[model samples]
Target: LKAGNMVGPRVYSTGTILYGADGDFKAVINSLDDARSSLRRLKAVGAFSVKSYNQPRREQRQQIIEAARELQMEVVPEGGSNYFNNMTMILDGHTGIEHNPPVWPVYKDVKALWNATRVGYTPTLIVSYGTQFGENYWYDRTEVWKNDHLLSFTPPSVIDSRSRRRTTAEYGDYGHIDIAKSVKYIADGGTKINLGSHGQLQGLGAHWELWMLAQGGMTPMQALRCATMNGAAYLGMDKEIGSLETGKLADMVVLNENPLDDIRNSESIKYVMVNGRMYDTDSMNEIGNREKPRLRFWWQMTRGGDMINLPVNNTETHLFGVQEGD
Candidate 1:
């Protein structure tokens, strides 16, 4: 089947999935017949989920949910940080709500929604409310940018972008307390919260997400569950990937310290095994670290390795942009 930004019946009948469709991409399925026909067409071609981009009105969402249920398909809705849409999606029914909802005036009906339906929640804390914690808080943390494991894979430009950046506080709001408090509220009330870092900073982003979840009021175990089992269950992969069970895949991390004592310790990783293949995280740092014959740096390389002849370059140097001096 051809894949592209195809629209209309071909998108579903021929198996083209729309990743982000705001307000059902303006295709109104108002009647039951319209809903049934549309969803049945999708299911016939093996489409299982409908992704809404934070714009569907309550009735529209309800219709989508009803149609999905009748067809045994899942509706995964993203509310784009809008409080009303997020709450409505949760109430109306969904497989998961993407990212944390807006922080101000926390959603009070979350527990009711949880009791009513089996919806999953993904906070996507790192990109969504990470800056809300405070610019100074992130900047002052030595470990965020200094960790050898992170710096090994992270580009100097990415590090610079995240470092020393000012928050919206310049306009008078100095912090992200509301979002943090709301996160704590939802977790405490027993809603199934899942971890989502939005793919920022690669592997290191998950640790940052867990740390922020702890800051938001989750116990270390609860936050860890959000990172592990909750996410697996949401993706329908818990039977295989979430825990260290006998029949599950051998995927797990060996940490240097107990993350239960402090979530930040999650970053202190020693080894990671996926599908029974073990990786020395420290040794993985060396693979792309050097140019043997001549010294040319692609990105920041952690110091003190056997690649001695290769001179280390300044981490602040941008690879593409050049100024006056050589």
Candidate 2:
């Protein structure tokens, strides 16, 4: 990729390397050549990592993992709906898990696998459990989306959809308690836990994930660490942006309340600093008001705010893309 190649006003740069799979089944990588070809293409694009979309068979998965490992590429396996499938992925030693595997109750067997692997976990709780307004869920939970701060940066169209009613089948909550239990088990086990929103609602979605983690019994400190330090460590960028270290980038939020006391207190954002410059949080919210709504009022309400412009420290947000090999 060229240094000045621009997608809109933003310059594109090298970052994450994603390896898509055709289906949610094993035997996806049918041969060593197929596996190596994927690796070769990954290196050619300068991607430092790869994700197996629907996971291959145990042996196939191992071959893919070995190929990526030989070239020092991180392997993140995607776990869909099956819990046992996730267990096998962990046994194969992937670097991290993409979605929260259906690991409810987090039994002794699961703990054994986790203890043996100690891999990073990203439980995208929002997509798994966040309310879908279009489906008329969480309507009584006004505390979820009624905050002035959330509404401020949120588009008016989305704000208006809060009360709209629609009919759609939602994911059952049968596994919720177990999911939360597993989060507690894995986190307390000292495993690195990270928050994954899976596209719930942008900034608000992340906070909700944190809240879910806390509700799952993680202390505020532990949940914050999972969101910040653990995430940086997962991407091998801990030295660059996780903590308030003296040498790290000043990419941080100015919270009006101590998140340590309550995870929801994170929504009380006052200002955001990026690249040594400060931006008024209200001004950032105003930016949303001027932008046209991207979807129907009800549809927008059901999704995350992927388009929100909350700039930090003036640094260009790096695009997670494949880089040309050196």
Candidate 3:
């Protein structure tokens, strides 16, 4: 509060710990009791939540979730192979999934899993970057790319195609289903719809997510909540900035159109209020820059420019005297 600013967005840092099968978590913290202690340590350090990855066994995953619960920490699981595993994590107390490819993505039953999220917020940012979405992203026409500059580049994310590694339009286009499921889940009864942009250009992909959410079935307001209020609650800050309550920080955005009627209206932000101060879009455009990549665009060579030329699944896989790839 040194800024003497009467208000500010209440922030909570999510601490993610990468653990391998034979790492320190197993070597040093071998017992279930030790796991609880480790989580407590993370909480003591101001981490609102602790996330560990690279788990290879069901037993191990369950143990971690239990240990976190014993310590009252929200458990977040990253590995998903099918709808079974996805549902298991939700039932076993995982806050939400982090990838969309693991489900092999079929919206036919996504409403079931999404319903689980209604009891809580599940950030589908994984659905946007992983799965076939990224593949479709590469296929994005020049106009589509410009329309989605965030996915074109700047979104720091990954592809969870590791589960099956199938290729085709089916590989990269389940993004639509993810949005559809998210919408149905929220409309059915969700109170919080945590929006996860998967970290790139904060504005770019985040807006895409909202737009997709609306396209998939969410009303404008429902989609807006996914990015704003719901996201705040996922971070454990429901008392501060999720709504326009008194004593809450004046953190909000002023859009040209009412999002309750059109989710895409968010892209029309004219102003932002943070810490009780207004940031006009004109001034907002002048406060930020960009970052360099840590990896040499691995997808470029591994996948080739085939992204734009790839064929859609279930439609036509072959053309005049040539396989789509050939």
lDDT, model 2: 0.63
| lDDT ranking from best candidate downward | 1, 2, 3
> Model 2, range 1-326, lDDT digits (tens) per residue?
13423211111222333334553432347666677777777679777777776644666777888888788877777776667777878888888877777545667767767876768888776555322321132333444444555554555456446534433343453344357667789777667888766655656667777777876788889888988899889888889877899999766778889988777788788866554445456445222224322222222232353432433222122322355898
Measured with C-alpha atoms, the lDDT of residue 188 in candidate 3 is 67
Tens-digit lDDT track of model 1 for 74-106: 777765767767777777778888777765546
Candidate 2 Cα errors over 4 Å, as ranges: 1-28, 129-140, 143-146, 166-175, 285-326
What TM-score fits each model? 0.72, 0.73, 0.65
Report lDDT (CA) for all predictions: 0.63, 0.63, 0.53
Off by over 4 Å in 1: 1-48, 105-110, 129-137, 164-175, 285-326
What does candidate 3's lDDT look like per residue over 115-188, in tens digits? 65533544454344334453243334213323332332222222222212333354335565564564455456
lDDT of 1: 0.63
Candidate 1, residue 232: how far the Cα is off, in Å: 1.0
Models, CA RMSD each = 8.0, 11.1, 11.4
Candidate 1 versus truth, CA RMSD in Å, comes to: 8.0
TM-score: model 3 vs. ground truth: 0.65
TM-score rank, highest first? 2, 1, 3
- Among all windows of 10 consecutive residues in model 1, the one with the lowest summed lDDT is 5-14
